[model samples]
Target: MHEFTPPSGTLLGVGLGPGDPALITLKAADAVARTRVLAVPVKARGAESFARRIVAGRITPAHTVLELVFPMRSDPEVLRPHWQRAAQAILTHLDRGEDVAFLCEGDPFTFGTFIYVFREVARLRPHAPVEVIPGVSAYHAAACRTLTPLAAGDDRLCVLPATYGVEVVETMLERFDTVVLLKVKPVMDALLDMLARTGLTGHAVFVNKVGTDEEAVVTDVASLRGRKLDYLSLMLVRNPARVKEPVLRGCRPKVGA
Candidate 1:
């Protein structure tokens, strides 16, 4: 006599968009609705989860919400254990044939906490079913809301965390036409100073909590100096005066001959 084993359920990384419930895609909503276990990331135990709040309306009594604590720190060693624990917790439900959907504020693979968990899950279960549902990133929403064109004909764009320091940011600004600085809370003043030094202060825009009711956009980025900013804030900078290589089209040079 032989005993049969049930197959594991799938792990769904659902991006809910940038703080806007309406921005969630139809497929993401369907996944959330069908999944019985909803794994949400929070800063601490019992803390509010921004990702969960984005899909509050979709949650029902039948759903089992699992809060995974992911502290706000950049130390990978400190975060690794948390990620492994979260992955194991989600896997437990999956082993029971219950699909687990991990909610994310933006695109799961774009600097989202889901990436860490996803990596751990893949390591733990090499053949586990997984699906990633993309959503509008914070920078994309900020650019669209500000009506700023990220890139155009031969223009380059760079997106990085502001914690990389002002020197690196300045170098990126020099190399790319458009630069998006994410999580500008710690280096707000330094970035503003660098922008002013590069004569791009007026071309920079600061967007905070984009797409939500408390969203704010600041055209005068200089005013943000010395002021505490939210972690969700980001800056979109455009350098129109950046030197571009001459493109020869039909025997005619676009720039100086």
Candidate 2:
């Protein structure tokens, strides 16, 4: 006779939104409320987990919280092991038919730590059930708070980490009508100088921790130079004078048409 085996539980990647608990989607909240095991990403052992903090009110004693360390480093070699270990930790719970919800600050697929763990989970358990619940991204929240339109008419938009260097940013500014620079802490001064050089200092606005009590919006972006910025900070710039591409007939219709 063949032996029966219990099926593994589902792995959920829940986005809690950008630092604001209210921004969490209904689906994401339901996932967190129902799941017994919660995997949260932390910068170090015993360090605060921003994702966990966003949902602090929802966490009860019945929930089993697991903190997974994901240091603020870009080196893949150093990050791979952590991802593997976090995956294994979550897998341990899944094997027991217990759902594990990995909480993230923003949309799970948008520069969120959940992506790394999701990758490892897929590799380790190829057939495991997985679901990603999307939430409001930081840039979207920043744009909404500042009342800035990310794109209008035929305008183009670009979003990337400011660590790509000022040269790349400058090129992007010339090409795209709107550009959102994430994690500008490392290159704040350089970016300020470049914006001034291009006469775009007035066109940029700095926002950090949008949608939260600690949220900040700076209209004078140049003043941010020499000041330390949080890793959660970002800049939204609009180049209204950017040359628009001519629309070829039959290619695409005009915005109002």
Candidate 3:
């Protein structure tokens, strides 16, 4: 057996992947296996750990799961207080020399709540080591779930939160080579309406709970007219022929050989 090193003082913002625990990257899995404390969100008296559920099968009682309560509202009045509390909890762990693996649902740097702690801890203790482990983002999982290639040779890829309304989506359809609409709960209906009218509906796919038992992939946007959806879902629409740069376009010299 190898010597077990004492926990070094560091913070690892680990990504748990989209939904399936099996999809977690090898590096992320190693981080989880080594995490001393796993911080999770606890809302109200009985809210689910939507993020942790992504890795439920992999976690064990041996791994400490710390719940950091977060308010369900984004009201300016309540937001700061919740963030402060979350930061305090993580800082407490750091002070103990136990590295914290703050698990996030997707890429740690991409919309992960771990930033709140990252900023606060760095501000207070400038020399703390912080490392981010990348995982399979929702868009990548969704695209794979639907078997849709995001980009081709020289094809562009743009991922945007679905908080934008129909108008913004229409604008994206106009300019981008491909679009992955995330956090798509609120505007599913309106966006579907826009895609239908714009004739882009056929190329779009609605993906939910990818890589899990509840995973779903729908080709018809209108089919989801009034259905309930998990917030972890995404919509992928691609048009690969937009800017096909010929690999051999510049193969020959400008002047004849």
Candidate lDDT scores, in order, read: 0.92, 0.92, 0.78
Evaluation by lDDT, superior candidate among 2 and 3: 2
In model 1, the clashing pairs are: none
lDDT of 2 by residue, 23-133 (tens): 999999999999999999999999999899999999999999999999999888999999999999999999999999999998999988789899999988888899999
lDDT of 3 by residue, 1-257 (tens): 99854443788888878878777889988888888688887665467887778778778888988887766564646766777777777777877788888888878877666777678778776777899898788788787767788877666788887786668877777767799898787888888888878778888889887877888888877898788887778899775434454556666578767
The C-alpha stretches of model 1 lying farther than 4 A from their native spots are 1-5, 246-257
Q: What's the TM-score of every candidate structure?
A: 0.93, 0.94, 0.84
Candidate 1 lDDT (Cα, 0 to 1): 0.92
Global local distance difference test of model 3:
0.78
Question: Model 1 over residues 64-102: C-alpha lDDT tens digits?
Answer: 999999999999999999999999999999888888999
Q: Candidate 3 at residue 119, lDDT?
A: 82
**TM-score of candidate 2 versus the correct structure, residues matched by position:** 0.94
List the candidates ranked by TM-score, beginning with the highest: 2, 1, 3
